[model samples]
Target: MSSTTQKCADMLCHRNGVLKCSRCKGADPETFYCSPECQKSDWRWHKKFCGKQAYVFDVELLGSSNPKITRKVAVPSWYTFKQFHFVLQYIFGPWQNCHLHTFSFLKELGNQRIRSDFSIRKEILLELCHEGDVEYVSQNWFDEREVKLSDVYEEDGRLRSKIMVNGNFAPLLYEYDFGDGWEHKITFVKSELARAARPLVKEAVGCGPVEDSGGIQGWNKVKEAFAATQPTTEQLERRQWAREVSGLEERYNPLAEPDVIVMNYEGRWENHEEGYREDERRRTAF
Candidate 1:
């Protein structure tokens, strides 16, 4: 049912509700509540199946090491690709949205993998394209602003027909920071409703890499240097380099827990909307 017309799932209340169940926000037959009190009151019955089914994903940073970085997140199916990008940034290092990114779809053909002809990219990339690049942009790219997660995956969490290869769905690839080549493999883990309208992190492992600390190889070097017990001269220099580059007064720790709360707050779509509107106003003023 459309979000606007949905009624409170509390059988007795049946009020036209706006708040979705924290654990079942994106379920097919979505559950809602008019108030937290109603939701709490209904918990006894609802808890049985609240988060049993929904859109869940495992996002792993492709080249992380020392401990390997990964996160399990529950995302609403209606989220746009742009929103997904923000979610990734939040869960990872709370990455500074300083670079361009793309979402690629790949199909398996026998033993070889082929990237789908088209990719979804940030809207700023399209805006930056010159007139001469219009055809190329149109043929190879889709604006992330226009595509929802549901457009790529079915309500049942299966890949849609057109994009499926040999009746199997492929994991989606997200590449951020073209210069650093920070690639993340996004694998659909299960069909389960998320806890909120915003993506929720269910699990997190290892620490996110330092921005501009080079790429995977550079990050690995930093880890090796810091992990050393009896440091060699070169390793000491490397540690010094990492500190300077990362703006850390002390050695970088690869195992520390990320500041997830701050990340989620900064990455909220509402904050993005405010920034986007301000940018639009500036552009129009000029």
Candidate 2:
């Protein structure tokens, strides 16, 4: 993929090189504007869902060598990206849940924009550039604890202006486990009324690679060991190691694909707390 980035989305500066960019708090997290003025001017249309809204994000693991990892999640507009991180842990079961990660809000670029309707026009300059093309500036990084999901959103529950003003909606870049180098592209798919206070996993595909299974490559080896009709000593050891850490030694399937679990917590809201308690009881049962 080319390393080129799109110019800011501000209409006034149609040809002006982008100085800075932010994601929209409105319906599209992929659209961005060049300046705050452009972002605010467009807010009239975006403000509709800025309050008490929720979003469904399509998250896919980037840079995976094999077994594409993806999930569709429903979370409240008020959740901090940090809270959503936990929800991912529940679904993917990252190794020991001990990993370092960061979220980048810059415009989605290159092949990462997989949506068929996704536009590359934002990356193009309609008129000859004149503003002495500003050098690409690095986006500011915030610790998970420092920002809430709503921090990037507007008061009405739209995405924060700072995140969307200077650029078009870009996927929320979440790279986890630096050692494993698992990069996830989190895109805001749609907005809706809040279902409940807790987060939900609407759909999931592909079991998350075992944590620290040597990133994608190691993960592949682990899979082969499990699928092996007659396993090698090394394969058996790796398989056993994964089982011990995940606490699924007894039922861990070497040849089985990850189960497809579709959970809508909103539908089971009344029973969720009890379910959690029961899960805790089982966790301690052993």
Candidate 3:
């Protein structure tokens, strides 16, 4: 007789006969073998549930008249910003998440479901979604959100939205044939900040970043697309916030950025609390 429910040994999971493995698409493939030892032994299959090493970085960088300007950035609480996009891709897919970035994506990722702390790391949170399929539902703002219980497939990314802007959180898909394989992508309009300026920065002085746009602006966005830069955090204030977010701080390199592992508290929305203020050192042009 087929059992209605089974405990999964791998992924520490529980399975209803109706639901199958997302990674294997296996139907009740004896997930639970009735022992903790059985589950530990079955981790090879569970390992597939995780994606490629999350730190896919593109080394292209932006040029600045001032050398002190951030070559690296860090987002608060997270070491690897790829964790965000990885979850989005796993929950949705690369193309769907690309469609999610068309607007003021600068502030759209801040939703409760988006930041839930299921595990010490955000990537592990994806494990919860791996157990089921995700569906997309439109918010009144016209943007889409995920519903794992309702939809068969869901994939996308969103920024922190303070004011709701109505638009479809829809997927705009793209494809590139690599001969050996077809690479898919999602297309969307990208916008740049128009702050009154200092010197105009280029993605690279002579050689442009991989993106054809070829300006400081292009570098910022392109590095991410190329998987070069990940959002990083530099704790402007350590006693107040750095201690809260950092796991460990070891020296990065000598000569230039000696304090390579700077504090990153990007999501903090508090008053600036710097005790000592020194005029920032000016950088001679490189």
Number of the top-ranking candidate, with lDDT as the measure: 1
In candidate 2 the C-alpha lDDT for residue 78 amounts to 70
Model 3, position 147: C-alpha lDDT score? 23
User: Candidate 3, TM-score vs. the true structure?
Assistant: 0.19
Ranking by TM-score: 1, 2, 3
Deviation from native of the Cα of residue 219 in model 1, angstroms = 0.8
Every model's TM-score: 0.63, 0.59, 0.19
Tens digit of lDDT per residue, candidate 3, span 1-286? 2346665554444443333334433433444344445545665655433221111111211132222222111111121222223322221111122212211111222222222223212321121221112232112212122322112111222332222236432221111111211111222222222111111111111121221223344324433332323433322222123122222223211112212211122111111111001111111121
| All-Cα superposition RMSD per candidate | 8.9, 17.8, 20.4
* Residue-pair clash count for candidate 3: 30
Residue 158 displacement in candidate 2 (angstroms): 9.0
lDDT of 2 by residue, 1-286 (tens): 1112544445455643333222322333323555677767755644543345677888887755445778887777776665666566555643344555545564544554322222442332211111212122122434454566666654443346545635445446665675666767778777676534566677776667877777677888887888788999998898899887667886776344444443453344335444544654675486
Which prediction has the highest TM-score against the true structure?
A: 1
Model 1 lDDT per residue over 73-150, tens place: 888777777778777776775365556666766553122211222333221111211133233443335667676777
